[model samples]
Target: MTFEWGDLFAGRISGMAASEIRELLKLIDRPEIISFAGGIPDPDLFPSAAMARAYEKIFQSNAGAGGALQYTISEGYTPLREWILGYMEGKGVRLGLDEVLVTSGSQQALDFIGKLLIGPGDLVAVTKPTYLGALQAFSPYEPRYVSIAMDDEGPVLADLEAALAARPKFLYLVPDFQNPNGVTVSADRREAIVALCAAAGVAIVEDAAYAELRYDGEALPSLAAIDAARNGGRPATVIHCGSFSKTVVPALRVGWVSAPRDVVNRLVLMKQAADLHTSTINQMVLHDVVSQIFEPHVKRLRVAYKERRDAMLAALDAHMPKGVTWTRPQGGMFVWIELAPGRCGVALLERAIKEANVAFVPGAAFFADRSGANTLRLSFSATKPDRIREGVRRIAGLLETVEA
Candidate 1:
């Protein structure tokens, strides 16, 4: 008889599955595949030179090296948290150091929030076709999900109001150029949504991973910012998860969470228990880099990514059949596509890779209710504009073949 490790696994393990996009990303290594499956940053855009200098400066100083190499506090480096406070204040949300936590990445922040708030059969609200990573993080904790359907202006107000009526423990959303779908919630809707959730005594977890990557439209205030306004610039309902991965680089895995002091305190304890804090050296290096060039670096990314986005939209328009439709995102890494009736995204992905040497993520993975069979997500962030055009053309050609 085989030694069954499954018998000894935690019950939560049963709810976790390998990420669908992560698996598809493996095809990118083959060289022949034009993969748009993962919404990862382009390596070329990473501030490799700045990062090298930051590390060199750290090690050159004996005092800096000693502290960096040593384990640090779970609450994260104080100076970094201070920087976060300033950044949040810029967005009209005021935060104290005690209300901040430096997480390994925003992904960890989501997991911590899930563990903090979710219990077996607890109700959680999520946008329809939400971030797959969030669903993955929360699933292990075993909360049932109620999904709010989204329109171009963001989650439909009627749907959100209905979801809130169920008395969920929290509502999770990516307000700024949401993942899988590139829709940003309008300013007025943000206000209405904040007020509704606050009134219902429901917490909001705002994932701002792609907030700084906008290419069009004026920047809107975050949910935290609006909620803070309700209570004299203090966090009232929103827990914001922010990341440097989209703007800077992902390898260092630096992200942060800001919430009310008590919530942050609990998360800090969880952080201490999970890994005894993020890498001290990495945190210091990240702090140094962002402090020096965060804005200019993000500006550069916006330009480069915007070109690729235009190329993808153009290619889709030029090649796709009339029945096919896709969203024109103002910012972020993804373009969401919806096929005509009776079509399937998964089937199209299989045929695209096999016959056209292209790759993308089927949108059903992002749906907590598992309903988006004809929808898919394409990422233009990593590929060059020419390659993005080629990839979209190939996928469109393949899609046509399937229709025939």
Candidate 2:
């Protein structure tokens, strides 16, 4: 049964290292285990009934118009793009509808950007501990990655400048409640980064996938907003990618990138060739859900998730042993934990699963160089408050037992 195949699989896979998140998630599925893996939202938050209604409504209205079951333009449904632009305008990123391009998801937007701009050996700067998915999406392109150092407030300026001095094509950032680290760039840091990137002529790829999940403090302005604030009246150097996966249902896969009109045109062309378009049915359903039901549901998500975030933080504070530190995120799904030095999250994960019956993503998967062995990413988005507390308690007990 052996069939001869070429070395297509021989090439390096972009960011395709063993995914600790998924691996741990498998273990966490056991009835006895508590999972702090996968940055997924709770199913309770999904407006399943409303979504069904929206789906039915779309079919009823458009069945005669081919039921919107047919193929759509690669640029996406015009009304959805217009709605997204309107939503962004409220967030301070003033842009025309033409600048928005929808994709299957925000992940696809990253892949499309990598395909369009990144070639082998092209320099792309990323935060020291960054989004695992970003690394995955961009890795296949084989771009030479430069991991810029970061702090609690966000990317270190000197390091960013040093990386940008080499004239990288773009710098990737998860500005608000960042994926693994759960750190938001301070206002000053945001301003400094924008100013520096502007001077260096380095484009910034801003991933605001968790932007709407803010739980405390005033809403920080997005890097895209900062770009417009600083670089308005010129061709924009910021590529803003975002998704409803966090705010709404991930399965719907509605995400968009707001760039200059020229950039949008190119992405539209690329997208046309990629999948022809995102699903027309999904887009139509989303339009209906978004216009009628999505926003209010998001407000509910905020209230519920904030409580969960608080619970996780409190559990970590009360239960984790000394010398173990974690991020106190105001919003978003993850909390980056730094275990006592020399403790590899990967190595500890086995004990955590088999002994403690708990799981969290090992930090190594998020690093480009596999240097963060002592780090771990715990996602609070999926688990409930009681379970979050229970999970931390169980893991904390394991740490103590392992020590003894």
Top lDDT model:
1
After superposition, the stretches of candidate 2 with alpha carbons farther than 4 Å from their true spots are: 1-15, 27-29, 61-65, 233-235
lDDT of 2 by residue, 281-361 (tens): 888878878888767888899899999999999999999998899899989888999988877788777888878778888
lDDT per model vs. reference: 0.94, 0.86
Pairs with backbone N, CA or C atoms under 3 Å apart (clashes), candidate 2 = 14-139, 14-140
Can you list the residue pairs that collide in candidate 1? none
Q: Candidate 1, residues 159-181: lDDT per residue as tens digits?
A: 89998999999999999889989
- Clash number for candidate 1: 0
| Alpha-carbon RMSD of each model | 0.8, 1.8
Which TM-score value belongs to model 1?
Answer: 0.99
Q: State residue 349's C-alpha deviation in candidate 1, in Å.
A: 0.9
TM-scores of the candidates are 0.99, 0.95
